[model samples]
Target: MTDSSSNTQETDSSQYSVLNVNDWSENWQAGKIGFHKDIEHPLLVKYADKLTGGKSAQKILIPLCGKSMDIKWIADQGHTVVGVEAVEQAVLEFFTEQNIEYSKETLTDIPGDVYKSSDGRISVYRCDVFDFNRSYKDKFDAVYDRAALVAINRDDRERYATLMKSLSAPGSRMVIVTVNYDPALHPGPPHYVEEELIPKLYGNRYNVEILERSDSLEERWREKGLTYFDEVVHFLSDKS
Candidate 1:
């Protein structure tokens, strides 16, 4: 007979499905993520000044920041880095992989543990994205989106944009890296967000610019029986 524990594990893995904090926790437990990179994204390095509005020190927000190396890169540049992620496992991995010491606490008005750096430059709140409180509105000087946007399903894109815009301080800047592709050819968690949708999403409140586009990941997608992510970067600024 097949092991009952194995069957239960498989069922939980697919059932939660990244829709909430519990789901992402399961995702990490199963090691299903392949999008993680140990190095800072080249696009972020190229446009760091633009993202921070040429400021060396600014408060930055990164959503869905899995154990990605980009956070370490930005923090090392002398800016405060605040990231929100759903999985505690991923948060721990970040500290472990980067060799940074952190302490965890159960914070009020938030649904998950808050892992904070020893020196206070980095903070990762482990919580469902939507559960973040509105009291944080207009609090960030800049926002960075590498894999955050395309990682979510399409139905939540509007809400995601609205939340990001609400958190912008006056004249705040944002650098969003997204994937665009033929939706029919891929199973997309890194979903295809068409170019036209950017304006519909953030144009009303922020000035938008298309900075770069590439097919560097095209071959990787083809290997997976799909086309490509067709990576694109966009720069956005608050109108106010």
Candidate 2:
């Protein structure tokens, strides 16, 4: 499901196919996740102060979190973490490497296998991110969105934003990290994320702030034969 396909038909078909738990699981079984980060993203590390505000004991929602080490960091800092990942392999790998024993059970609420790891510090639902029932909505105090938004096609951006908003409690805080790249050079899962789209998506429901914008991804993009990489870290509050 995470494959970067130039085939518009295949890509369009994925929108419907991804909703099926079995088909989505097959995508994971096929090892199609080219989007997983090898390391915890630097922006997430650098903006730790702004993202978490040195606060502990908050529950954080990580959308499309694929075996990310960021989950552990947030959990260790006294935040309970819940993440939704469509890929089964990534969820399985997360528990194996983190050395956390987990229990698998069917969630009648979401129609997927729910794996609760590390004494329930982390709960990962192996299902399409969009299919999760709204009973889970407004249950989180914070959100950590890394690659989920831009990884999706432009048409799905509003749905992504709506789902994120639903999960967040009033006055909840969120940090969104995205890379802005040129479409001509590298059409991608790391797709073009217009800066303006941020506010249009969440500003009506949240107070938005751009914490940083820099060409930090330059070295990596240059290696891929691309120029002009813009990375942004945004802090949002549900105060509005």
Candidate 3:
């Protein structure tokens, strides 16, 4: 996922802007993606059963997915994985580095392109997440929101949440992983997401539950002057 803007957290609602796609592209081009993890996220692996509901061939959506290894992992489990990303560089790197043979085609209904794995199990849409709309309404059975929500600007959350809802089918489940820290210390692509914000975003359509919270402040964040860091996991079940 592309986390936009400078390191300073913006408090004024008026100052918040839509994420910068070019910034993300630049990051990818320059190899400035420290946010990219080498392995599957530990939290995601820990809670895979909940996301899949012990079922196979479920349709899954990953928003702002930046070549996440989890996409390949989930697809290997016999599920269909769909990822939405903005930067072409990240998308290409994903397939090339993973050694997955893929084909690409431009999307007629929307801007950007779609890349599909030869196995037909994984597809990644190279477009801004916001541009992907209700055309995919009720398409996914579950969502894995690892870096998407936290990477978004605060002002766009409602729109983002609504988009998520529009894409998900009835009874769909979502697993979210968020990193929390004092915004005063450092601005973030992985911004501090307040616990209260979860319900505010999804309460109308989903039952939200706090699954776990742990101290996850890495040494780098500590060196950046953050006093504390908390990583939280949330589970959401559609109300319908």
Q: Pick the candidate with the highest TM-score.
A: 3
State which candidate, 2 or 3, has the greater lDDT: 3
Task: Decide which is better by lDDT, 1 or 3.
Answer: 3
- Ranking of candidates on TM-score, top first: 3, 1, 2
Clashes of each: 0, 0, 1
- Backbone collision tally, model 2: 0
lDDT of 2 by residue, 52-75 (tens): 656768888898888898888777
The list of candidate 1 runs beyond 4 A from truth reads 1-20, 134-138
Model 3 / residue 227 / CA error / Å? 2.6
- lDDT of candidate 3 over 1-240, digit per residue (tens): 244344334575322334478877877889878778889888888999889877878999999899889999889889999999999999999999999999999888778999999999999999889888723444799999988998897767899899898898889999988888876666666777889899998999989999999788788888989889888999999888
Superpose all Cα atoms of candidate 1 onto the true structure and report the RMSD in Å to 1 decimal. Answer: 5.5
Give the per-residue lDDT digits (tens) of candidate 1, residues 8-122.
Answer: 2122113111244555576689887778876898889999999888887899999999998989899999999999898888999999989999999886776688889998999
The positional error of residue 10 in candidate 2, measured at the CA in angstroms, is 14
TM-score of each: 0.88, 0.84, 0.92
**lDDT of every predicted structure (CA atoms):** 0.80, 0.75, 0.85
Candidate 2 differs from the real structure by a C-alpha RMSD in angstroms, to one decimal, of: 4.1
